[model samples]
Target chain A: DVKVTQSSRYLVKRTGEKVFLECVQDMDHENMFWYRQDPGLGLRLIYFSYDVKMKEKGDIPEGYSVSREKKERFSLILESASTNQTSMYLCASTLETGDNQPQHFGDGTRLSIL
Target chain B: SQKIEQNSEALNIQEGKTATLTCNYTNYSPAYLQWYRQDPGRGPVFLLLIRENEKEKRKERLKVTFDTTLKQSLFHITASQPADSATYLCALAPADAGNMLTFGGGTRLMVKP
Candidate 1:
């Protein structure tokens, strides 16, 4: 089975503080993504990396950034946490082969900015 | 702007009955569409994917149909059980996009025993 492990299940941070969310996938997929899911708004893509050290902005990338230092790990960073940034963050990875490949997701990190 | 929409916010059905969900999109040409199941507080899990050229696809009890002209996809679960109750999400991948997906708000299914 494909395993996508997230560093934390729940996290709390004060406003202006920096927050980091980590994700590691054992499937050796080449593509990784970060998304924030909220009530009624669904999952909005924050950022995605197609390969190591290469990242691209998604629909809502203004307040978030991502790092893919190695093929197996990806990290999401909040430059400065804010109340509006509190949401359930999800990390997913998929093979770069074709669009037909399904993305495997981590359990998710519920981050709260107070 | 391109948009994806699910037909309803919630659906209630009895066990053993078939559950059907609808997904629609506009202003974008998607090469393929996918369905996912998400329980509360958990990330969505991939369920099925149907390409634009494929009229229908199935996996065990789950079935999906895609219509490029109407830009709509229908997901059906046969003999749905209580365990099948969860929020179902539909995502679209446009041909122009490399691998990014656009997801709908999702419809929550409640199957009563």
Candidate 2:
């Protein structure tokens, strides 16, 4: 079975603080993604990495950046956390890019900005 | 802009009944559609996937149907139990897009015993 693990389950940060969310996958998947899920808004992609050190901005990438220095790890960074940035962050990994591959998700990290 | 929409209304059904959820899309043709189940405060779990060329796909009691003509998909859960209560999300990937998925808002289903 494929397993994706997030470094944190819950986090709290003050306004303008920096926040980092880490994710690691054991399946050696080539694609990794970060999304923020909100009620009524659904899951909005923040960033994605297709290979080591390669990144792409998604639909809602503002105020967020991602790092993929290695194949097994992906990190989401909030340069300056704000109250509006509080959300449940999810990390997912897929073996390849296509319709046939299914993404495996981590448990998610609920971030609170005050 | 490409968009996906699912029924926002909550569906309530008694045990042993079949629950159906609808997913509709506009402005883009998807290569495949997928269904996922999510519990409160948890990430979604993959349920099933149906290709544009295929009419339907099933896994045990869960079935999914995709209609390219209407750009719609239906997810059905047969013999639903209380354990089946959760939010169901539908996702679509365009043929030219690489692994990127646009997801609908999702439909909440409650199964009563």
**Model 1, residue B37: displacement in angstroms?**
0.5
Encode model 2's per-residue lDDT on B26-113: one tens digit a residue. Answer: 9989998889999987888988988899999999999999999998999999999999999999999878777888889999999999
Fnat value of model 1: 0.62
| Model 2 TM-score, 2 decimals | 0.97
lDDT of 1 by residue, B1-113 (tens): 99899965689999999999999999989998999999998889999988888999999999999989888999999999999999999999977676789899999999999
Tens digit of lDDT per residue, candidate 1, span A1-114?
Answer: 899999999998999998999999998899999999998898999999989999999989998888889999999999999999999999998988755678899989999999
Candidate 2 C-alpha error for residue A9, in Å: 1.0
The CAPRI class of candidate 2 is medium
Give each prediction's DockQ, rounded to 2 decimals.
0.71, 0.67
Number of the top-ranking candidate, with DockQ as the measure = 1
Q: How close is chain A of candidate 1 to the true chain A, as a TM-score? A: 0.97
Q: List the residue pairs that clash in candidate 1.
A: none
TM-score of chain B of 2: 0.97
